[model samples]
Target: MTVPTLSALATQLTSYNPDSLSVADAQQLIRDYVQATDSSETVGLNDALCRVLSEDVISPINVPAHDNSAMDGYAFRGSDLGVEAVMFKVVGTAFAGHKHEGPVNTGECVRIMTGAVMPADCDTVVPQELVTSASEASMTLAPGVVRPGDNRRLKGEDLMAGKSALRKGKTLHAADLGLLASLGIGQIPVQRRLRVAVFSTGDELRNIGEHLDEGCIYDSNRYTIRAMLTRLGCDVLDMGIVKDDRESLEAALRTACESADAIVTSGGVSVGEADFTREMMAKLGEVAFWKLAMRPGRPMAFGRIASNGKSAYLFGLPGNPVAVMVTFYFFARDALLRMMGGTKDSTPLIQAASQTAIRKKPGRTEYQRGILSMDANGNPQVRVTGSQGSGILRSMSEANCMIILHHEQGNVNAGDPVNVVLFDGLC
Candidate 1:
């Protein structure tokens, strides 16, 4: 498949203005241009958690392999069961991993354990607890106690041989590993982990363990971005903080592009007197700087950048602490997942009632940090975490979800429904 350039993708949009772009348009442009990596590798089951599968896993053998008892009970021929109480003489015992080899004649049954293969002629099993007048030699079952094939697991019931056990593009979880193990599969083909280079740029920002000047603050965006990347199973290359100089910033971008698949930077995208990210990005490659119609994350940049003939996708996030997290979760998260060959999108949005009336203006989207909880009736309700300022990092820590006010949405009433994206798994 051919990958479209950013300009080509923008032309397809209804409106293309870098100065003022909508959130939805920006997301669509990124989705259309970015492509998944074609490279894949074989990994052991122990190391394949959360990795996207490159191919379908076919079942080598039938699940359960053969007809077996699903419960510890008596296995008998269903033809011997009648309308009245029926008694059967116990002929033999069948344990798990050991099939009953004796022949079951009419009026005779075999004592079977859970997972034990049933006798060749038996088609039903009566749970031991449900049997009446039970003894070592015989047991009695009331009429209608169990129908034919009751408590019996059919062969290939869970998964049949030569069938697709797990489809391609699936993100393997714990249960998927167990399913593969049950089929005796030890290794699987999975997409290679995405390599992402992360850094922060600002003259006033100081790294941890450094002496803070009178007006300088410690850098936190790099740590947060690294954590989010780790959760998505990316191989993060922490490039530390770059000084707010043209040469320093250019060197960092070039180094990142050469060694990483994607580059993420904060603080230099906004239009400020000292900000050179926009200019440097334009010089390095095809980048689009936009003033988004969104709250807390208005200034953003996205495009592909090349250094020394090696290229990488660049995501220039805002400087504000909260804005960095919001834009990443909403935009960069999905793009990175796609580049890694993952079929899943970002965390899904669910509807929740606003606990209080939220003041919102039309024509701009807002991502407010909120505390999502269950009401007395067991429905989700959300409220803002005090201030919704972009620079306030505490709000994000206190929030369990983000209350998303759409681009055209107006003021929200106290009990009005609103869209909310959870932070539990994504953040």
Candidate 2:
């Protein structure tokens, strides 16, 4: 895949300049430039949860080797039914994992259990509950009780032989394990987990459990980034806090580039005289510093950097508590997912009514933290958490969804519909 230069990417954009790129444009640029890591390993199905597949899985045989009964009932030929009640002699019983020795003749039925192979001459199964009367020798069925092929599981009904069961780049879920087990698959080829090194750079930052000075604050970004990386199945290297200086920053970047597939640093990306992180990043590799058209995370740096011929994707996020999360979610999250060889492109967004009025500008995109719940009328509604400041981590903590206000959208009135992305979803 060809990675276009920043200038070439700018030429393709007609709406904005590279310096002031929109959120959508930046996301697209990152997606185009970042490629999947080509590394794979075989893992047993029991241990492959949350792992992305490396190759398409084709079934070697039909899921169900034979036509079977879907319920415990009497299996009979459909041609034997009549207007009045029909009586049939029960020739024999068929249990699961056991088949009848011979086929049943007309007016004769075989007692069958769920998953029992259907007799050669039987075309339908009437569930035991639906059979009004039954005895050791015979059973009785009404005229409208069953139709042809009803309650019968056909051969290969779940999966056919020589057909693709799961595709490459798919993240295996619980149900996927069940399906693979049904196909008699034991081990699967999957992509290796991505290695991501994360750290915070600031002289005023201290680690948790450390004594804090008058101007120092605990470094939360590293812990936050590590937690998020762990959730994404990445092997995280937490480098702790690197003081804001030329040598320390350069050393950290070099070490990360040499060891990790991706590097994430929070703080010192904005335009400040003390912010030497950006300068050191440019010295190491070709990185683009942009003033994004988005709130809470306006200044960010993104590009590929290398040290000792080893390269890694770099994401320089902002310093604020909430801004780090917002930028990471909107920009770095999907990029890292792609680099992990995942096929899932993006998270789905839902539309919900705003419970209260919201003030906004139209030039930049805003990701407001919101609590989604049912309204008085039992409809989906969302309301913004108080104080939508970039530094307020409480807003994000309280939010179950992020109410997305687009770049071209304006102030919203109460009861207005807005787009939202949920944090929790059904497994």
Candidate 3:
């Protein structure tokens, strides 16, 4: 059977839900797309931060390897201690990164520091703070403090042998590397990154170094899209800006498909006399354009364009700078993330109290650019950042949070409980 056009396939995909699909449905769509993607292996540990682990890592040995002192103290046999102050000779010394093979008898003690292995026959460590002194012969414990097991770490108490230390599908971070290092692991297997191509189309667009004309604006969508893609851990192929010509846009999109896993574009998908993105999608692959019930971002498109048996999905965002950003975050971000083996939990939601008065008439959900702050009670409160127009990119930059006004809602008074989106920590 002949495959349908990109637009037709989008219709098929969206036939299940169209108007006001819940965040759950959107996330499921992403998961379905991700499950359809190919997986590959990569040798990445240092550069794999924020990437998910492709395999489970078993511990080669026990964590800590041996019983050690958890503090600077004296290691002694608890059974040898009397109800009164325990007396024992300090036969040897052990510090962090150092261990003594010497045995500590019932009447003998050994000076042991944090990370130092407890000598044979020593069941407990008394920190020097609770001890009178440390000597080669014997040490005396103070009358109070320092329990019997105080400052002592038992063998395999933290990590046991043959146990799974890190599970598959776990996202690696700085702390993960430390966990690997503690297990004597230097390298790890990680999933390969999805290569992506990003571009924006419009004749009214101008690049850096070129003077802006009366009707043109500097290309801001490209930078913003690139940054967001990087955050999702995709290797971005910046295709730069293409003119309104169909051939130029088609070639750029084709190259992205051939060399990358996906192609992301902002602008040119909307209805206009000069918009070639819709025409290109018609000729190249199956595409879907949805007029989302959202402010700033409404015309969102997604589909796959094939080239030489390899196909990369495409995401067409709005041309308005702020709209492009908001749409990308809410819609395209998770799809791209899923392509890279990630699962977005749900649609963007945040907890914040309304600080100022908010007036609205909503048949569609509105994301009002907002700034969130802590009230005197330390409760998070948010206020809208002036204008909610999609073309106002500065408003997005001015605000750090997004007040997600639900559909079928009216004006809100101050101190009302409202849902918000905390992006880039501006809230």
How high is the lDDT of residue 225 in model 3? 86
Off by over 4 Å in 3: 1-24, 80-84, 132-139, 142-144, 343-350, 360-363, 407-410, 424-427
Clash-forming residue pairs, model 3: 5-286, 6-285, 6-286, 6-287, 7-287, 88-138, 88-139, 89-137, 89-138, 90-137
Question: In candidate 3, what are the lDDT values of residues 1-427, reduced to their tens digit?
Answer: 3544533433446433544443334444544544424585765467768887777889999887888888887888777666677677778898787778766677888888889988888878887777776566767886555656767888888888899988876767788888888888877877788888988898888889899999888899999988888876778898888888878988888888899888889898877878888788768876654566667676767777888787888888889988888778777776766665554435557778888788877666677888988989888889888977888888988888888887677788998889987786221
> Cα lDDT for residue 147, model 2?
88
Candidate 3 at 375: error in angstroms? Answer: 2.4
Superior by lDDT: candidate 1 or candidate 2: 1
Total backbone collisions, model 2? 0
Residue runs of model 2 more than 4 Å from their true location after superposition? 376-378, 425-427
What is the lDDT of every predicted structure here?
A: 0.93, 0.89, 0.76
lDDT of 1 by residue, 60-138 (tens): 9999899999999999999998999999999999999998897999999999999999898999999999998788999
Query: Distance from true position, residue 419, model 1, in Å?
Result: 2.1
Candidate achieving the largest lDDT = 1
Model 1 regions more than 4 Å off: none
